[model samples]
Target chain A: MELRGKELNKSIATRKKEVLENTSILSEICQFLELKDVARMRSVSKIMNVIIKDSQFIWKPILQRTFPEVRILDHLTWQSLKNVYKSLRDYHYLTFEPHSSYTVGIIGSLGKLKPYPDIHSPEIESSGIFGGYSNYLLGKHIISISVLSIPSIKSIRKLRAEIQCWILQVNGQAQGWENVLDEHVTNFKMNQIKSSQILIVINSDQEYKTDFILDLEKKFKIVILKYIDNKTFENLTKAILKICRNDGETERKVYEKQLIRTNIDENSVQETNDSNNCILS
Target chain B: MFYNFNKIEEVKIRLRSAEGHICEVEESAALMSSFIRSMIEGFNEVTEVSLPNINSVVIEKVIEYMRHYKDKDPPIIKKPIISSKMEENTSAWDAGFIDADWNMVVDLMTAADYLMMIPLRDLCCAKMACKFKGRSIDELRAEYHIENEFPSEMEENLEFQHPWRLE
Candidate 1:
């Protein structure tokens, strides 16, 4: 592929060189006879016409140059390829020539133009562009940019640090301990927070890792909580085993791994016999 | 050192100036082809690369844009925060950058044209049109450096009273 590309480029360069020399020689002969340019040369009748008609003649190189990229003879003429690259390259400046062209403006339906309110507006200001509500209450806004934030993995990792700083922005108030429960509930209601949360515990009895899960459950209902699944869970388990087995916590590691891998349903209650068997065995 | 990132490409382009300082542009297939075509026909390196219409200021702006966008993907039809006030209350950054005399604006547009920077050229041209949005042809001529070519009677007949201007 590379070799073919190089050969093609060389061919183009050769053609361009021939065209350049032809133009230069024509201009030189025109200058000698005090003729203006190509148009004037064309006006000099039969001999010039015969010179132009010859395929290999230097004078008619312009016609050949018109369609250099076209190899098939069916569409090789200058007039046929007038709208192609040659004409564009030659007449680029013509587009910008004053008085030669004009501009047209097409106005569609003129919608009611309303003045956008400043920051001091009393109510929530919503303007619809093709109908996606921009939720701005009391002038808190989101400025949509032309470019998307194509975050790298490094940038995505930095987002964890910024999570602490990202205020949920609930009505101009920051959520702390006093508001965590209600704030979480409000976000849940607004469909903003995640419905599920995962808790991973390795070697619960020996390392007191169960204590952390119990404390969390005491604070918030574990309505949708579950452990990790498959490959990632296996990797995490291996890492945990590597950390704990060397630290004299074999009993806790065995029990906790089994407990986490087990799935539970909140709505369905197993029979008392099965429940006892689950907890005991 | 020039082809540090990519090994396959091998060509060099020289951008020249009046002081004879030649800045070498690393060859990419697209740019090198255009450069070679320009350099043909007794036009040397200086004549090929030197944009006579683009002064240093506009060239600096084009280079700035290129630097900013080198590693980025092309922008789609994402609507940027167009200043809420239809030609008023632009962000200070955008306003200040674009607020140049008409000559500088035209120079920047020409530079954008030479560098084939579509967005910059379009922005400058659109800004020029926006500035003359509701104005008459006579007003546009006065604002731009365009000379009036109409006969006096025809010019009088074509006069339009602009709606936006208080005067």
Candidate 2:
């Protein structure tokens, strides 16, 4: 059965590759890639280059997936997919807070928009560039302020420590996290967080363990919840995650694996699950 | 998926997949595929439907979804919104169902496309789009097993092509 599965996969893959390369199926699969990446893949061969250049159908799925609420009958000279991706990200930056996450202590509210009281109305201090806004809020008012708590920060530290430990072990007497970062710990001494240096750090450490990205994401999420409000957190989070982001969306992918965990009625996606309606994660 | 027939045996439809694996599914479950629905409507009460393009593996997985959603329609994914409730896994069973390997998913997508099952196709595509999020060009090539046949000049100037990504 295993051999049969392998053969079927192999034969089908080869056949599909042929059909895709020869027919318009490559264009179909190219539809799945971002426009810039499509252009990048076009670099592969003249056949692909011609297929991508001639391909006018990429925006169809992009429009369908990005803007489901509106029906655009007319053709559009689409802006770059990166622009569309950025604009679509505006959807993820909703002010609404999930009632379930609000109810449970799992997520501290940065002040719910409506349908819930803004108990403390979180005193948010803005970080101009990185949007890494963090202002300390008092006891009972923490939920209204931010999800960042002493415990969460402590956990963030622990997460960073674990990574540093792993990096140290992997380096094996070479420069450690401290030596690499020039002994700065609490905050990054430099703002080169998204630099290729960090990318190298992420890629090198990721092979040792799968959770490296997930762990980075966990810390990133914790860091954002500190002074989060709409695009502030998401913008910063995206930048942070862009450095070390893997296929893992941290909690979402893992919980999704334990199927049957989600029972909430997701039926309203067609009618009212608009960007404004959903609470930001 | 069985209920008491009270003396009369339950009526079942046979699905002959590409590999000749025959699966017995209820009529209602089989009707989830619009193609099958039309076929059933047009034809005389035939007991079997042969799907030439979809294999047994794809059939088995598709049937699993059809069986589960026979009664309730799967949620339509209109836009790309990752829910806050994704942590609890409440109500989004279709996402979990379509979580197969790359080859299986592509095949299932092909089968779904052939069957004209828009919901399943959308789910598969949306899931694929979700994976596409935040992936680098190198990563995309690696995962998709596509070749980079860029001429040296284009390769040298690739970063210049997408200046935004370089940002």
| lDDT leader | 2
Candidate 1 residues lying further than 4 Å off, grouped into runs, are A1-281, B1-14, B23-53, B73-96, B136-167
Model 2 residue B8 CA deviation (Å) reads 4.9
Model 2, residue A280: displacement in angstroms? Answer: 55
Tell the DockQ for candidate 1: 0.02
Task: Give the 10-residue window scoring lowest on summed lDDT in candidate 2 chain A.
Answer: A127-136
Q: Top DockQ: which candidate number?
A: 2
Residue B79 of candidate 1: its Cα lDDT? 21
What is the C-alpha local distance difference test score of each model?
0.33, 0.45
Stretch of 10 with least lDDT, candidate 1 chain A: A101-110
Q: Which tens-of-lDDT digit does each residue in B1-167 have in candidate 2?
A: 98666977656889899889898888888888888889888998888989989899888898898899899987765444343122222245766676666677777878888888877776666655555444565665565466776767876666565554532
**Which parts of model 2 are misplaced by more than 4 Å?**
A1-49, A61-281, B1-9, B81-92, B156-158, B165-167
The TM-score obtained for chain B of candidate 2 when compared with the true chain B: 0.80
Give a tens-digit lDDT track for model 2, residues A155-203. 3232332121111111212345324323322223232222221211211
* lDDT, candidate 2, at A114: 15
